[model samples]
Target: MATSGRREVARRILRLTDGIEESHEVHEPVFDIKDTPIESLENAVNPLVPFLPDIRKHAVTAKKACKNPPPDGLTLDESASIRLYSMEWVPHDKCLYVVLNDTLRSEDGEKVKPWFLYLKLFRTAFERLPKQHLTELENYQRAVDIGMHSLPSNHPNFQQWKKALESAKEN
Candidate 1:
């Protein structure tokens, strides 16, 4: 597949996940890691280990899977960290992305402090990925198509994004 096609597929996959709403306005300053030094994935998300079960194991497994990888000029650790964040824990609520997304969207920005180190690694890793471009129309079409084919409508969360997208189209 072409680079843009791969990107659209990945975008559609992300859309299927429980992402934060785009309209949520933040009143507090965002924590960034522009000047922060890099750290191991374990150390980055260690603070969250107590709150999230099996996260350490998940990180270890993810790192092992990507040991020899070099995706888009990133270290193996960066690649594995991204993979770890994407991993789904047994309980849907315990998923790393789900929790992190919730923390990021919290009304009190202070709640996001614990995630600073992990966010720095996550965002930095994503930023280092190679560019992939596609038109908005193509992106939208692919999202719908992917949802229709990959996610059965009978699924509980299917209606969430499906209806939202339909409603958006009507407006």
Candidate 2:
């Protein structure tokens, strides 16, 4: 988990949740599938054993909280899971978000390690997004690409953006 990866995860989390509280301490260790060790769990580090379960727990909690939580009493874990889950129901992305949330909440300094795994999971999940969602995602991606481009020239993909912007402006 290099520093850049950790920051990417943070950026994605913010993009998915619109600025919610997140953890950056979940332990993520790579495993050799060929090696079978019963005690391997003991060596896990991202968020610790107890926090690993938080992903599922928070996911369920997020679903419930979406409909009926106090203004500021519930943890973002649940809400985050619910929204991400709703987006596509792709387990991999949801898993990344869950684990990432766990990492963000963690304090042990193992946050960067899970970056690759989380990104992999995100790709898997993103692949499952619906057609309608793909359009929306493309719109967002195009906006980001244009905003980040280094060249002085205007972005070539401006028609779709203009349509989207005009639609938004009309509303």
Candidate 3:
């Protein structure tokens, strides 16, 4: 069931970014190691460039919609469940991943999860994306520890990010 749901979500996401492509190659350090200097991290983690304004707008709206969802709209937990499952380049297999807070459960003690959507963005989107969303992507990466095992205890804004994750985990 979850697999089919994921496919549907992926289809929707692909439709949303249809026609977008990378205008140029993107170069950045691999996300396999931790403790890499932030200044030295040059590659844009999640290349969301071509869909810029719309993507950012969608993110902002999603954040708000998650916070105060309508009666028939997604709940906070539901929204958090809808996350970036994968963003990878076809040739190299490089990817950006998200870790979900999976504390939400159903009455039967099974995990009542949402779909995970995968998107393939153009490499050029990295260069064209707005700074705010870029920063947010970094935060998202940090939250999920995409490249590393865990976020550093002393990393700046760690508490705030943790709190945000906690809020999303709530029922």
Candidate 4:
């Protein structure tokens, strides 16, 4: 049953990401790993990007929604390698069910370096989703606690380019 559920989730994710066109540039609002203080995008988003191409597609879909919803049957947890990531309820005692498709961004005739770097960025962005969402949730809670009923004016995530700056600091 878990396997079936995972497969269904993968199918839905695929459908969502399949909307991106090859001709147009998709403006994805990704957490800029370059400026993020983290050592590497890999450190920010591990297991999540295990299969790059797949995750890239989902990212495109996520961009459309402007939200980061975890894959079905998955739960966020602290992984030693990533500040925050998730482990799905894998059947047969496996740890993860999603496979990030890292190869989708590569050109048919392109060299390997760009593909490698892009995939790295993609993975980091994927991993950063949980952290960002958690931070947003925390910010929301903080706002509620203080009776503001809205994000604080100085809320860390409210500004443009905040992710890049934060990532740079971590680095």
- Give the top-scoring candidate (TM-score): 1
How displaced is residue 159 in candidate 2, in Å? 20
Show how many residue pairs clash in every candidate, following the order shown: 0, 16, 1, 19
What TM-score fits each model? 0.64, 0.28, 0.20, 0.19
Ranking under lDDT, best-scoring first?
A: 1, 2, 4, 3
Highest lDDT against the true fold, candidate: 1
lDDT of 3: 0.33
When 1 and 2 are scored with TM-score, the better candidate is 1
- How much does candidate 4 score in TM-score? 0.19
TM-score: the better of candidates 2 and 4 = 2
Model 3: per-residue Cα lDDT over 14-114, one tens digit each: 43332233222333422221222221011222233232223333344433544454232433323322322232232212112211112111122222111
1 or 4: which has the higher lDDT?
Answer: 1
lDDT of each: 0.70, 0.42, 0.33, 0.38
Residues 69-134 of candidate 2: C-alpha lDDT, one tens digit per residue: 423333333333325444323344355445554554554445534343323333333443334444
| lDDT by residue for model 1 (64-91), tens | 9885767557888788888888786566
Model 1 lDDT on a 0 to 1 scale? 0.70
Deviation from native of the Cα of residue 39 in model 4, angstroms: 18
lDDT of 3 at 33: 17
